[model samples]
Structure formats: C-alpha cells, structure tokens
Target: MHLISYITSRSQISEKSIQNTIELLNEDCTIPFISRYRKEKTGNLDEIEIGQIVQLKEQFEALEKRKVSVLKILEEQNVLTSDLKQKIDKTDDLTTLEDIYLPYKKKRKTKAETARKNGLEPLAKMIMSQRINDLDYTASKYTSNEVESSEKALEGARFIIAEWINERTDIRNNIRYQLERFATISTKIIKSKKEDEKAQKFKDYFDWSENLSRIPSHRLLAILRAESEDFIRVKIEIDNERALQKMEDRIIRSQNKCAEQIELAVADAYKRLLYPSLSNEALSIAKEKADEAAIGVFTKNLQQLLLGAPLGEKRILAIDPGFRSGCKIVCLNEQGDLLHNETIFPHPPQNRDTDAIKKISSLSDAYKIEAIAIGNGTASRETEQLIKRIHFKNEIEVFVVSEAGASIYSASKIARDEFPDYDVTVRGSVSIGRRLADPLAELVKIDAKSIGVGQYQHDVDQSKLKKSLDATVEHCVNKVGVNINTASASLLSYVSGIGPKLAENIVTYRNENGSFSDRKTIKKVARLGGKAFEQSAGFLRIKNGDNPLDDSAVHPEQYPLVKKIAKDVGKNISDLIGNSSELKQIDLNKYITDTVGLPTLKDIISELEKPGLDPRKKAKAFSFNQNIKSITDLHEGQLLPGIVNNITNFGCFVDVGIKESGLVHVSNLANTFVKDVNEHVALHQQVIVKVLEIDVNRKRIQLSMNYK
Candidate 1:
C-alpha cells in the first residue's frame, strides 16, 4: 500500500508532509529533531503531530510486514487464488486481513476436522445449501463405518456446518458489531476472597456492571487488575437471544429441513465459536485503547514533572526526612556536587532538636546555602517546621520537594557510579538537592515508571510506556537545551541522536580533557560521527564559550546564515544575540532560500532573541497549612493549601502536608462538568482545596478544588 496516502487518509496531515516526515524518520532523525529543525519540510508540524506521524508510520510498517507473512503462508498452502490475492492486496486493516486468512489457517484435531474425517463433508454442504428437503435421507446416505447411525451423521454434519458459519467473515463481523456496541462487563466477588483484606481496595468493583464500550479507561483497568488479582471474576455479556437471532436471520434463507439444520448450526456457532472469539477480540481492543489512554496520561504527567520549575544554580541544603532513623542531610554546591553530608535526629526517640537546629544552621552558613529542599516523606512537615524555627543569617528559600523516586534513584547503579563512597541516604539527599536545582537534569537518572507520577502505570503495556516516556524526556531535554559543559551523562543521553554510549563518551572526554569550548569541539568526541553531530549539536549548549551562538538553540549549520543576517543588520553576531528589538525589525523574507524558508528564519530570530534561555519557570516555595500535619488534623470543610502531586483521568491527588494524599474527584474539580481532569489543574500546581471527607481508618481523604 501507498503509505503516505494511507497515513493521510487516517490523519489530518497532508500527503507531502507525511512523505517528508517518513523520509526524515528513515534517515534516523528523531521526532524532536525533525519537528524542531525540519519545520519547513513537515509543513511546520509540532512535536505532537510529528509523533502521530511516527506512530502511524510504524503501524503501517507492522501491517505490511504481517501482510507479507500472511501472503507467504497462503502461497505455501497451495490454496491461494487470484481473487484471494486481490482481497489481501486491497485491504490495509490488520483485522480485515486476518479475517481473510482465517479460513486457510491450519488447525489441530477439532470436532469439525473430526467430522470431515468421518466422511460428513457432503452432508454438511447439502444442509448449508438450504435447498434439500430430504436432509434425513441425505444424512443416512452419509452414514458409514465411522458414523454409527443417521442421527450421528447428522450431528457430525452440524459440527461441520458450525465451523463453516464460524469461518464466514460477514457472520463474524456481525457478532463483533453486537459485542462492540452492546456488551456489558460484569464482575462478582470471589466468595472465598470476599472478606480478604487485600480485596477491600477493589470493593467498588466487586459487584459492578458497566457497558464495555462506555467504561472509562481507568475503571476498566481497575477491574482488569482486580480480576487478575483473583479478588473478582469478570465476564462479558450481551443479549444471547438477540445475538442468536441476528446470526440465524443472516444464515437461514428457506423454511425447509435444511433451514432447521442451519438454525441449529447457527446456535452452536454463536455459543461455541463466534461469540467467544469475537467477545475476546472486543475486550482486547478495549484493553489496547485503555492502555493508550493511560499511557497518554502518564506521558503528559511525566512531561510536566520533568519540566517543572528549576531553582537555577544555587547552594542547596537537602534533607531526606525520616522519623526513627533521623533525616539524612546533604549540602550541594551550585553545580550540584556533594560538598558535605550528615544525619540529624530532630523527631521522636532521639529528639536532638537543639543539636539538629544548631547543625542545620552551621551547615547553611558554611555552605552559603541559598535554598533548602526537604523531602516530602516521613517527618517532612516536622523538618519544615524545624527549619522555620531557625533564623539564619541569610534568607534561605525552603521548598518541600516531592521524594517520589528519590529512593529509587539513590539505590540505582547510576547513583552508585556517581558517588562510590556515599550511602543511599546521602545519595538520596544529593538527588533532592539536584532535583531542586534542575528537576530535568536529576529526574532523568531514574526510570519514569519509578517516578510515580502516572496512574496504573505498572498495569499498562511496559514497552509502550517506556517508549513514550523516553520520547517525552527527549522532548523536554531538547526543548530546554542542555549545557554541554556541565550537564551530566544522564541529561546528555536524552539529547537528540546521543544515546547512553555517546553521552558517556562525551562525559569521559570532558573528564580527560577540559570542558567543551565551542560547538565545534563536540565533533572531537570519540565515535560521534557527522550524522550524530548534525542531530545533537543544536540541543547541546556551551555557556560563555568561544562563540556566543554556540550556546543557542540555532543549529551549527545555520550559523553562516545567522552571521549574514547579523552583518545585514549592521551588528556583530554577539551584539545581535538577545537584541529582540533589532532582531524583530529584520526583514525575514530576504533571507528565504531553497533550503531555508521563512519558518526557519523566524525560529532563528526567536532563538536569537533569547539565546540559551531555559523554557522552564523559576522555582517558587510553597506553603501547606501549618496546623494540618497529619490526617487526624484534617476536618470536613477545612480549606488547606496543597500541591497537585499526581493527576489521573478521574482527578488529581493533592499533597496537603500529610502522609496521605487527598483525591479531588473530577466532579469536585470545578463547578461545571469536568470532561478532562487536566483542564482544571496540572501537576505541581499549588491550590487551596476544601476537605470533603476523610476516612481515617482507610487513610483516604477526599478533597474539592471548588473552595468557593
């Protein structure tokens, strides 16, 4: 099939754009690179549109591969006809192609095959024709040593007819339609596990029923999880009588005895073959859709969390809070190198409040700490209060950073390689400090799934989730632009065309030699070929380097064009950088050429206006309600300040300075009907929520964003 036209018919993109995108993709250009650098060729497609094209192109390739395999199988069976070849060639849908190949698939010993082996094929065909009035006589003629009697022969004929009906593409499609539109999924609590403590979390789904097509993705995933856990038994149901009647109407054409036989065969097919197969197919389709939706939610959340505000280069005092084991403290320099590490017992058992306060004050003063980042875990609120009590010489901004994946990162091989002598607690504290300085730089070290920003993340398809999250990291990293001089290997790995090996090589080269002085120096890294440099040079920045444009998002290939524009505007390239007024006044039309169009020129102008500027906002300190330290402190109607820590399709989970995060259901997200949870709030957004309910025993808190 013509892939460009096929993708165009499926998406809103033009054929030329799709063709160009596919060609670029085939040339090993990344989505971020293609969307950012090849805008003119792709009709100015953004990352989302470019991502859609990539997904569709992969889908087309997968379909074509499957078609080739199917065609080969058919040719090998020696039953391949010209009409069949034409049908296979004309269809692009994988399901339609499978339906065409179903009849020719090799099967094991089954009742139908057994019936054919028993010499009942003629009787089956006669019954299917619906023209024979003497079906009994025909069945008797078919009786032989294998068939004991005419009744037995008729039974075998019915089985063969059932297989025939099941194999009909139109009949299967009709059943599939019924299942897709009318199927109801129901669940029942397993009697033995009804009272199990582990099953209480899924009690809502114990006796639930919902239309399969209408069930929300989260809800379906929950039910499927419950079923997998053995806490409930789930079944897909449709109107049996209606489905049977539809099949009978489609297959039966006459009122003869042959028609009666066809009716029996239809019932058997519906019960034994068609309904079971089509219902499972429908469920699988639903599962795939649900996985896509869940993965989308995760991708968006990860993007927001990764691109969350950065505190910039500042001395930071980070604390990983705990109760009995004491809080692990680490002081980091402006570049996030661990300068000092210690432990302070501020809460319970060994409540060295005075010593803890004294030690923290001295560390802040000694390290010239500009900010403090406390882990939002055990004893977090207490630590914040402790810090508030101490009066430092300098004004230190205190941020309660989310510690979702700090432990995972602390215990990782990457962490061990970075800090060989430091323990996990010290490593975790360093991560918290680094996260405060630049979240994108530190969070890339941990797996996105372990970061804990998604809903039902582990339940979805792992491979697809990893691909999407990896792409998101790549997008965010490229969008903000990486500092080539100081960026860690983890951060550099996500740069376009630079995987882990190349990133390590760059870092190793920097360690042996000095830092990169200009973008040209990057080409000297071992194994970094011309294509790698072409794709990665734009995203990698060199601050205070030999050339000013080296730190900007403008690709090195366009440096000559930028120089011409600068000369035309009667200014040096350095003077032209960040001179928005002068850059905006330059006529872009004069610079358009065969390869460089107006879009590229406009982008160059914009980048020059803000060279090496971070796309993320500056970090700000957030305050939770001082009085609310734990779940018991919460009361109905009490308005408390919280941060949107996690978001799902239903609503967002808000951290209200307590161990338990409160849920704000979609209905409570706003005064109007909330179609999408993201429309009302975003991850890391600070808002005041009113407590709607609190289940102390269950440690569940329900909150509402509609405080008014």
Candidate 2:
C-alpha cells in the first residue's frame, strides 16, 4: 500500500474510497460533480487528480490480481519455492517480474534448453567459467557422443548457460539499460531499393539509424511504422566485441563461478532472449515519443482554432445554409439576445423569395439587425444571394462565418441556456451568429474535434485525438477565464476541472435554482466534490460577487491572503484587486508564502490587473470588393486580397471572394525554392494573391502568390 502510494505520490487511498469512487463511476457520477460535491470523502482532490488516481488504482489492483494468478500457476506446477515466492511478492513492475521468472518459464525448444536436455548442462556451465581458454582442454572433459566435437561441445555449453544467464532479470535489466546508453539510431537510403518506383513513400526511410536518444520522436515513429508495414526493417543488437569486452570486465572480475556463469550467460542471454523481447518495447517508445510531438502540433492548432477572436458586440442575422431543408435564419440583438428565428427555402422553391422577403423584412424590421452572418456550408452562396436581394445598405454588413462546431454547440448546454424553447437545429443557427460576434467565447462551448483542423481526422485514433484536443481546449479555457454570469454550460465544461456532463449539471442546477452569486454555489451541485470546485471555481468567474476576486482566478483557498494584500494597498479587498495602478504599487513579495510560489503569485497579480478579462486576441475586420459577389465575378489576371484558409502539399486554398475559395498550386506559391507548403503558407494567414485563370465551367479558379 505504501509502495503504491509512493509510486502514485498520493498519501493514501482507503479501500472504502476506492470502492466508493468505483461505484460512483459505475453510477455515472460525473468527475466534476463527484470531485466538487463529494469533497469530504476524497481528501479534496480535484477531478483530474481523482481520475488519475482511479486509473492508477485500477492498474495496481489488476497487477495484484495478476500476481496471485501467476503464483497459482506456479503452485499448480509444484515448482513454487519460497525464494521464488519472495521475488514474486516483492516485485512490482511487470517486465522485471517476468524477467525474474524467465528461467522457470515454460517455452518451446531453444538451443540452450535443447543442449540441457541433451545432458550437456554441466559442460555449458564449465565453459562459461572462461578459466581455461584452451578450448581443447575444456572440451575434452565434456566429450561424449552428444558433444561430437570441440565446436559442438562449446556451442552446446554456450547455449545452455546463455539461457540461464537470461533468466536472471536483474542482469538482463542492467545490460539492457547499458546497451540503451550506448545504442545509436541512424537512417540510410536503401541504395538498391530506392530505385524502385514503388518506394516513393518510404524513400525518406531508405536507410536510417541515429543515437536512439537523439532521434526525433515523430521521425522514429514513422520509421517504426514503416518497418511494421514491411517498407523497412529495424534492429538493436549490441556491438559484439565491445559487448563481450564489457561482459568480460564485469563478469571475470567476480570470484564465484555460478555468478561468473550468470554474468557470461547474461551476455549470451542478451543476444538470444532480451533482444527479441525488447523489439516491441523500442517500437512503442518511438511511437509514444512521436505521438507526443504530433499532439503538441495538434494542441497548438486546436488552441488557435478555438481562440479565434470574436467580432464581439454585434447584432447578427445568422443563416444556416442548406438546400433540402432550406436555410435556418436566426437574428440576435446587440446583446446576443435572440429576437427572431425562421426558416427560408428561397433557392429550391425559386431564386426569388416573396415569402422569405416578407419574413426577412418583418424579422429585420422587428430586430433591426446590424450585420448578417452566413454559414459557409452547403447552399451558402444561394443563401447569400437570397439575403442580398433585400439589403438595407449601410445598416448591415454581410460576413461569411465558418459554421464548424455550430451544430455541436447547438445541442450543448450553453445553447440550451439562451434558447430553452428552441430546437437543436434552431440553436445551431443562433450559434453561428453568436460565433461571428464573439468567436472565442462561443467556440469554447463546442468540442475542438468538430472545429475541423486536421487531415484525415476521422481516420486517426479517435480516443487519442479526443484526449489531446480536450487537453488543449482545457488549457485555452483556463487561460481565458469564463464569465460565470454569462457563460453557458458548454463553455464552462472547457474550464479545466469542468467536463461536459458536469458543466451541464452546473447549468441545470443554476436554472433550477438561480444565477450564481458566487462560486460557492458550486458546492450545492449534486455529486460535486471538493477537488472539482477547487480546480474549476478559480477559472469560472462571477462578474460582481461578494468577493470581487471571485470574478478573477484567485482561488477561494487564497482569498484570505488577497484580503491581506488589499489591506497593504490601503483599500478594501474589492477596491484594490481590480485597479491596475493600485495593484502595481503593492509589492508581490509581501504576499508570497510557502504554498504560493513565484509562478503562481505572478499569475495572481496579473489576474488582479484585469479581472474576468478575455485573454484571446481581438478579431480583425475585413471587407471584400463590393463588385465581387460570386465566383463568376472573378476575372483572369485580376488581383485580390485573401486569407489562406488551409495549406496542403498540392496547393494553398485562399478565401478570396467566393465561398468556394480558390486554390494556389504549389507551383504558384513562389518563383523559387518551395519544398514544403508549411514553409510558405499556414492556416488563417493573410496574403495578397493574383488571379491566374478562371474556368467558370468547372468552377475552378487558379490563383498565385507570384509577384505583382
């Protein structure tokens, strides 16, 4: 139990607590709720901490059960000894335990085991001593019908001892670690193989090996994966003479023959036993490192995608573009207050909209929309035209907003908060309008996966993808604290400890109860434990609360110290905290303590300067040429300004004027030296591109980043 605690770095986990959490997990007690509402029992651990503990506990229990099963198997074979029992009972890591039991482990024929069966175990043990290196003298004593010649005698002896040497897990572990220290990984082009036309994809890994430690994580994973697919092969056996010398120095110096035999045996064992077993281990290490690097890029992409600045403080008439179901139109007032919503099928029924005109005129007159946000989904162009026909001129600006994740948010708790009576489809339209107004705030409600930032996203490992994206979202959400007064359950879920289910529960509780006066209300939510509240409360802000710092990220645990800080500033806690100049005067060193390090203290000071501030970059406004409304409006040799929507190996897509967007082929990227698209263009980048060709028939427009 102490070992488990030390390994996991937890003081203790009572059986009762484990059973309780397991039962709650079985009963669907959401982590935030279980962590927040059920605080007393969990020792104040937060949702993430509790989740990790659960995972560790599960693994620990499984290992314990496995130990019993292994012992039972050995007992059944009547081979369980007190010494073996002690080793098994004492061991923790599965690999090391398996190593310790290898000598007694059952297996098919091996060279050493075959020689042992051939009555040459004694001879093998003798040769391993290396005390008499004459070869003939050593072999003559063990000579028999089974040991036909000196070569046969030595070979059989070496094989038997090697197996025994490998059975010692300690020696094998030491040698493995040593080899890892000395191992190098390198890559080389298979000179003969690269000539084949079929090897284009694997040409990068033709022949590569490097210092195992220095190999870039992603490159290593790629090589290993290539090898698994039979595009290449990898190996990690130790250098023979160097390894032999090291073993001789480490083994011969020891006095005991059995011990010396074990040492020499370990070297032989490394080649025959440990080498085969660790191939998969090396491959896994490579993949894990690769996944980490890939996830970092994925994390950055997710954060930027979510943190896209919102147009904030705009009255928008959002359109969900469609053909079969027509378009869903939702209007929002200056405050994101939905004024009216209606569906219009202006395209299919006819290019004109007598009914839509009436509805739009009435909704427009009633709501007085300041701008129009059109979803860049199916039928967007037609919808844009439909909306344009009845334009009120300067009163509104039409903007095409990416409707990615709008559907996800619509069915989310945040959406439900604004439109309790509206359906999911209607809520989706509202989300699109709100997104154009305040993208970062609205996107926080939707899962990052739905934001559409990857290549072949659906084909990758979904759970792994979700975990990485979720972590990124959490980091962003915490970085930009949510306004508890206005935040929906959807956005709240991304705030560190809060998850989707818990966020919904928080909102539900708020709806059933009332708006939160302070974060303390979190304690009232069903099943919420202390840990959940501790992690989430600081990040979830209430605009005007009893403790003004509640509107900032200063946790309740640090409130008393904050009050002391206020005293030092010669003002009440509320007055001094949010005043930037006043906060600047107060020394942070005065507030420092053992519990709060400089990193955390600095963060607190920053929060005080801008309470409940949205940390995302501000949105930039752009205008398209009034003359260009559709792809047909484009003319060859005409230049236009655009933002790079996405870059791929083949070309870069620029959102010039039309919703369809135009592609700038790799050839058109620059006049010289373009190896990778990433080096030239990136997602959401602004660049000046010239129209090269427009094939109106195919709806393909060629554009170029080539000079003016």
Candidate 3:
C-alpha cells in the first residue's frame, strides 16, 4: 500500500523524515529519545510530530494486516481477481477495504441467502436489470417447492434485490455522507427509570435533541454514559424522506417496468440494512472524535499537574486533614523522609485544640520546618486556620496542596515499600509533603487517571487514555530532566529510554554503590545496555557531578564540542559553563557538523546558561478568602479569590477554599464570548470570581468572571 507515502500524506511530514523516524521506532527507540537526541535525523521533529508518525505507522501496519486477511479469505473463496487485488492493495483505509469486501463476505442464513437457495436468483437478477416488462411472469417461472406462490417468489426476489442494493458501495457511501451531514442524536429517558435518583444528573439529556456534529465531546460522552447505564435510550437518525430520496437517486436509474420493484428493494435496503448501518457508523465516528478530544484534555491536565510548580527541597510539616479520626501529621526532612508521625485533633469531635497547637508548634521548632503542606480534603479549611493561628518559631509557609491521588498513592505497593512501618495516614501525609516538594516525583507513584483533573476520563477509551497520559509524563520528565542521584525509580522510569526494569536496576545499583557521580556511571548498572545509556543519558542530570556538562542538557556526544568551544575561547569548560558572554562570542556555525546541526548547538548554548535548572516555576503560597470557609459562608454577588483546579470544554471549576468547587461557565468566563475555556483559565491559575448563584441544597456554586 506504499505505507510511507500514505503516512507522509496523512501526517504532512516529509517522506524522508517519516521513513527515518519509522526505522528508528522499529529499532525500539522511544519518542523522547528520538525527538531530543535524533533531531538532526528527524529534521528537528518534536515529540508530538514523532508521536503522530508512530501512530500513523502503527495504523498503516494494522490496515496492511487486515488487507492480507481479506485477500486470503477471497482467495480461499476463489473469487479474488487481478482488478480486486489491485484495488485492495492500492487503498490503505480499513473502511474502504471492508466496503470493497462486503459483497464477498460470508453471512449466516438470512432471508436473502434463503431466497437465493430457493432458486429465486434468476428472478432477482431480472428485476435488477430493469428490462423485464413481465415481472410477474418472470417471478412465476421461479416458483418452486419452497416458493409456493408467485407472490412468495416476488417477495424472495425483492429480498435478494434488497441485499444487492445494501452491498453497493456507492449507495452505502452516499447515505453515510448524508448521515454525517444531517444526523441528529436524540435521547429519551426510560419511563421506568425516569424517577430514579441516579437519573437526576442526566436530566438535561432527557428528551433532548442535538445535531450529532454540534454536540461537544463532554456532552456526548455524558449522554452515552447515561445510555450505557440504561437510564436513557439514545438514537442517531436522519430525515427519513430526504435520506430515502438520496438513496433512491443513487440506486435507481430508470422509470421502467422494473422501476417499482427496484424502488421497493431500495426502500427495504434503507429500512433493513443501510440506514441502521450508517447511523451506527456516524455514531461510532462521533464516539472516536469524542474519545480523542477527551484524551487530549486528560493529557494536557496530566502534564500541567505533573509539571506543577515545585516547592523544592524544604523541611515540610504535612497534614492530611480529618475530623473524627484526627488530622494525620508527618514531619518530613528536605529529602522527604518521614522524621516524625503523629495525630493532631485540630477539628471537631476530638477537638484537642490546645494540645494540637502545641504539638504542631513543637514539631515545627524541632524539625526546623521551612514550610507546612496541608491536603485540601476533609477539614482542610479548618486545618489551615488552625495552623495559621499558631505562632511558630519559623516563618513557615503553609500550602494547601491538592490531595487528588494521595489516598491511592498511600495504599499503593510503592508506598508500602517506601514506608513499610507507617500506616496509610502517615504515608499519605508524606505524599502530600513530597508532592509539594517535587510534584513530578511524587505524582508518578499513582496512576494518572486516579488524579482528578479530567473530564469524563473513565468513560473515554482506556488504552488511548493510558498511552496519551504516559506520553505526557514522559515528555514532562524529559523536559525538566530528572536528577539521577535523587530521583526515585518511578521518576527515573519516565526518563527517555529508561523503563521499569532499568529504573529499578539503576536504583538498586545506587543503593549498593552510592549515588551516580556522572552520567557515564549509568552504563555500569546491570542490564543497562549501550542503547539504553545512549537514549537516557542526555535527560538524566547529575548535579555537582564529576563532569560539568553531564549536569547540562547537552548530550555526552557533544561534550567534545563544548570542550572545543571552551578551548576556542582559550578557557576551560568550567570557566565557560555559565559565562553567557563567552558563549556569545563563539560562532554557532563553527560547531555545526554532519551529526550535529545548529538547532542542537543552539540548545547546548542555552543549556549552559542555566545548567540543570528546572523549567517549572517555584511553588508560591496562595491565600483563600479567610471569611468564606465553606459553602454555607458563600453568598451571591460576593467577589472572592479562587484557584482553577479543573478545566473542561464548557468551563473551569474553581476551588474558592470551600467544600464545593464553583463552576465558571464559558459564557461567564469573560464579557466577550469565550470559544475555549482554556484560553481564559488554566490549572492552578489564581483569579477573582463573583458568585452568580449559590445552590446550598445541591451544594453547587455558580461563579462568573464577567461580573463587575
């Protein structure tokens, strides 16, 4: 099928670039490695472009495999012809290939197959020819033991003719095209389940009708979920009269004696086969589009959450706020090791406020805690207030970190291994502190889906979702460059070519042999091969390493070039490491070689300017409105400060330091129309929202940024 040409045409990448990228992928090279290290070979293609190439190549291979299956089936049937083989070989689309093979496909016993078996095939052919004037006489000739009467024979003939019309590619494609343009998706609440409590959330979808093409991904997924739960009956349909007219126009050629029979056959096909098939096809396409959109949102949110501002290495006092069980508090050192673990009753039920205050203050003084991290769950607001009232010895910055996946991480095997002696509460508190310290390292311990930042994430395609979120993690990890000496096995696994086994080996080697002093030491780890080292070296950082460039983004292969640049300036490598002026004097053209291009050389110069620096911003302290503690405290028309916690197509959900997060609909995001909610708000962005409406009964808060 000329897969390279097809992929190039589809992806809009150069043929040469696609070929090279496909070869590299065939050699088991990861996208992160290819995009960052093989830029000169891929024409400077980024990860996204490389990912597209990989997807298209995989798709082409799947289609090719299907084509082989189809060809073998046709050959077994002894129906494969040169022209048919050529057609199948020329087309790479699965749908097109399946359409071409539809007529030849074997089916179980049906009315049409039964009709053909009853010797009514000649009558059907006569009717389809549109030349028979005596159609009744022709049908009468085909009457036999199975077909008792001429009417029965004609009925059988009509069934065969209907099958023919259904199998025609032109008619099916035309109807499919019309369906795509005119289809409407309708949902009806099941009468028995109409009053069901679980059905109330889907009230908007009940008795609703919308153009299939116009429905947003989230809305469609919501409706589909309702349908799957049997709360609603969903249907995709088009205008019957217009759809039938289009089908007849494509199938019927003349107004002759057989025209009426052909018309009947076409109508039967529309009702029995074509319409149902095309409606499902339209729905499937819509579903695929929705899946892609949902996956894209999930990927973006995961990336933002993973690359969220890091609080850096600070001795943190973390709390997983609770009520009856008391707040779980853990004091962590700069390295995120649990130094002290205890319970503090700062909230109701066990309100030992005096003792809790004393405990917190004493721990702060003892650990020399630089910051306090409180999980934004349970009695988080009250916990924050309790901590704020304490007059600690240090000017501790308290952060209300999102505890989205802390529970999942705490109960995980990874957590159990890291702290076997501690309970879930202590482990959770440690996670909260570690997340504040280094978000990427801590968050990787849990599944991305468990983190609550997506829209209909569970309802979307699971495998696709996993692939996309995994890619995002890899991208963020490689982008920020992991510290080999300090990064955990989970964090190291996302670094370019390093997977689970290699990451574990590196960690085990480190535990036995101490920290990796340079990038070159990675190769000495058991089972870490040359290719793995080559792919993973550039993204693994070694701070204060034996070699200075190893800490920078420059590949080990380019250490010589940096050395040459340093020698050219008549200075050692250390003298030119951070000296931007010295770097500026050297011509980038002088360093360009067959293997290295200006894009890479320019990157090396930029890296030297900020060696091993994290691209993420520093985590800063944010304050919620102290007066508004919960939903009960919120009032309409009151402007309050909030942080954007989750985003979707329709709007962004803001946490205004309350139990219930408020929704700022896209229409209320700005005075002008907001086409995309993301353009107006991002995850963790601080903004002021005016309370438009408050539903205390539903525990829902509607907010708006358009208010004065």
Q: Which candidate comes out best when scored by TM-score?
A: 1
What lDDT tens digits, residue by residue, belong to model 3 across residues 365-469? Answer: 999999999999989989999988999776999899999999999999999999999889899999999999999999999999999999999998899999899
- Cα error, residue 707 of model 2, in Å, equals 8.0
Candidate number that wins on TM-score, 1 or 2: 1
Model 1 clash pairs are none
TM-score of 2: 0.63
Q: What's the count of clashing pairs in each model shown?
A: 0, 29, 0
* Model 2: how far residue 621 lies from native, Å: 3.3
List model 2 lDDT by residue over 460-562, tens digit each.
4567778767766766677677776677666777775667788878878887888788878878887678867766777788867766877876778878877
Give TM per candidate: 0.99, 0.63, 0.98
RMSD value for candidate 1:
1.0
Candidate 1, residues 1-708, lDDT tens digits: the string is 778877988999988899899999999999889988998899999999999998888888888999899999999999889999999988989999998998888988889999999999888998888888777887889888899899999889999999989989988888888888999999999999998999999989989999999999999999999999999998999999988888888888899988887888888888898888888899999998899999999998999999999999999999999989999999999999999999999899999999999999999999899999999988999999999999999999999999989999989999999999989999999999999999999999999998989889988999999999999999999999999889889999999999999999999999999999999999999999999999999999999999999989999999999999988989999999988899889999999888899889998998999888888998999988889888999899998889999999989999999999999999899999998888889899999999999999878999998768
What ranges in model 1 sit over 4 Å off? none
Lowest summed lDDT across 10 adjacent residues in model 1 is found at 129-138
Mark the 10 consecutive residues where model 2 has the least summed lDDT.
2-11
Better of 1 and 2 by lDDT: 1
